[model samples]
Target: MSDPILRLEGIHTDIAQYHILHGVDLEVPRGAVTMLLGRNGVGKTTTLRTVIGHWQARAGRILFDGAEITGAKTPDRARMGIGYVPEDMGIFSDLTVEENMTLAAATGPLDPARRDRIFEAFPPLRTFWRSPAGTLSGGQKQMLTIARAMAEERRLYLIDEPTKGLAPAIVSTMAGALRDLKRQGASILLVEQNFAVAKALGDYAAVMDDGRIVWAGEMQELATDAGLQERLMGLSMEAQ
Candidate 1:
């Protein structure tokens, strides 16, 4: 296999006086979706923030495509081809969907081909092109945020809990969009708690506990092993 597109080695982060992430080691292989799985408050989100420079790493190194980016600024990281969608789905409430997408383009105008691809992935984006982002439903807002990240080409995407609080139908739509991205060979580091979504989209899975990775394996293996799921994520059969 090729070298991972994103790697975190012994990463530690602190929020105020509290230590949130303790020595996290993770890898997201090229062209694969690596699921960062854990219960709430286990530092999964902190790890993503550290990677994208929203939270500085107190220690350890972050590598993107073999270059050390531990000290890189957030904009530098984004310029280096890291796309991020935070848990809050950072959309401009007053802006139209088109305006929000235009702002996300790294270079000049959005590439026509990329715009078509994004529309294909989330057709609602096309339907609500001129609508205020705030006027859209929760699911449409989520789609807009994801589409904004895809407005231009990106080497890696750091997405946090995208399906949170959405209806099952919307979750399925989001999952299908991610699946299309996977087919298009996009590399993603996804932090998700919904086991169903994880099982649907993860190529590899890493389970975190108290700021440390406790298990790493194939997604299918983790999905089928209910006992392991129960122990690692406190998941019940129904949850799976």
Candidate 2:
């Protein structure tokens, strides 16, 4: 791969006593989407968290753009133009939809043009503009989290399972929004379970098993070869 926006070399991460990631070497090409595919509980989320500095890596080098961010604090990582959309859909339930977006603005008031763009990408956020975040459905909440991350211009985004349990229509909407983000030149490292969606959006793909990257190549190659898909992703993974 060319010079990537984000790179992890020999990453090892432990959550308390349980070891999760073992030597996770990966790269997210600039201005493109890289799908991290794996079965349930195979350290996909752990990898994204490690990149965002949510969980400190036991050992490894994490480079964002060109600088080492292996030891940077989570807040510092956020400040340095990295946006994270976790699996949990981090949001303030008590806050209104508008409030949540305003908070994500961070530096100052939300920009008018950016807010409009977010609303265009996710119309539900506009519908529930003044409603508390808790009032929205699961898909809407997912949209909100993604919208929050898109509220500002970031160099890269770390998104985990944006379509986990969403309706097909909502999933389509989410996919379109992600495509727009790619068009806008934001590098995204996405952990997605829906292989169809992954194939549609990804330029490159990495398959993880037992905390290590087992397969990596262009998404087109993985999409076209069923044998490779079965060999790398397996029936166990697709069943999930």
Candidate 3:
């Protein structure tokens, strides 16, 4: 396998006197979806924030494509190819779909190509291209968030709770969109509690508990290993 596109070694994050992430270690391989699975408040979102430079890590190393990005500014990291889609979805309420996409467009000749690709992944975005962002449903908003991230050039992407509050059908649509991005070679670090969605989309899975990754392996292994699921994720057959 190739070297990881994103790697964190002993990453520790502190948010205003609160130690949220404690020596977290994980890797997002190039062109693959790496899912971070955990119950709520286990530092899953913090890890992504720290990676995107929203929350600074007081200790540890973050290397992206072999370059240390631990201290790089968020914009610098984005320019260097790391796109982040937060849980909030970051949609401008008043902005139209087309405006939102245009605002996030990467700096280069790839703008048109990116737009076309986003349209391909999200046909709904194209159909609602003239609609206000706030008028869209939860799923469409999530799609817009992802499409915005794809506007920038990136080797790795950090997405948080993308399927948080949507209908089952919309959740399936979101999953399909993620798969399309993966097919286009986007390395993704996903923070998701939706096990079914994660199982369907992830290539690798890491289970986090109390700010530390307790287990990491292939998604298939995680899917079949009921023992690990129960012990680490607190998931059971009944839950499934």
Task: Give the candidate number with the greatest TM-score.
Answer: 2
lDDT of each: 0.90, 0.93, 0.87
lDDT of 1 by residue, 87-166 (tens): 89989999999899999996889888988988888889899999999999999999998898888778899999999999
Worst 10 residues of 2 by lDDT: 231-240
Please tell me which predicted candidate would have the highest lDDT against the true structure. Answer: 2
Candidate ranking (lDDT, best to worst)? 2, 1, 3
RMSD of each: 1.2, 1.4, 1.6
Report the Cα lDDT for candidate 3.
0.87
Q: Estimate, for each residue in 144-225, the C-alpha lDDT of model 2 and write its tens digit.
A: 9999998888989999999999999999999999999999989999999998899899999999999999998899888888
Candidate 3 lDDT over 1-240, as tens digits, reads 469898899999999989999999998888999999888999999999999999899999999999999999999999988999999888897999988887887574437777887888788999999999999988889999988998876788899999987889878878887888888788999988788888889899888899998998898898877887888877662265
Clash pairs, model 3 backbone: none
Among residues 3 or more apart in sequence or in different chains, the pairs in candidate 2 whose N, CA or C atoms overlap within 3 Å are none
Give candidate 2 misplaced runs (Cα > 4 Å): 236-240
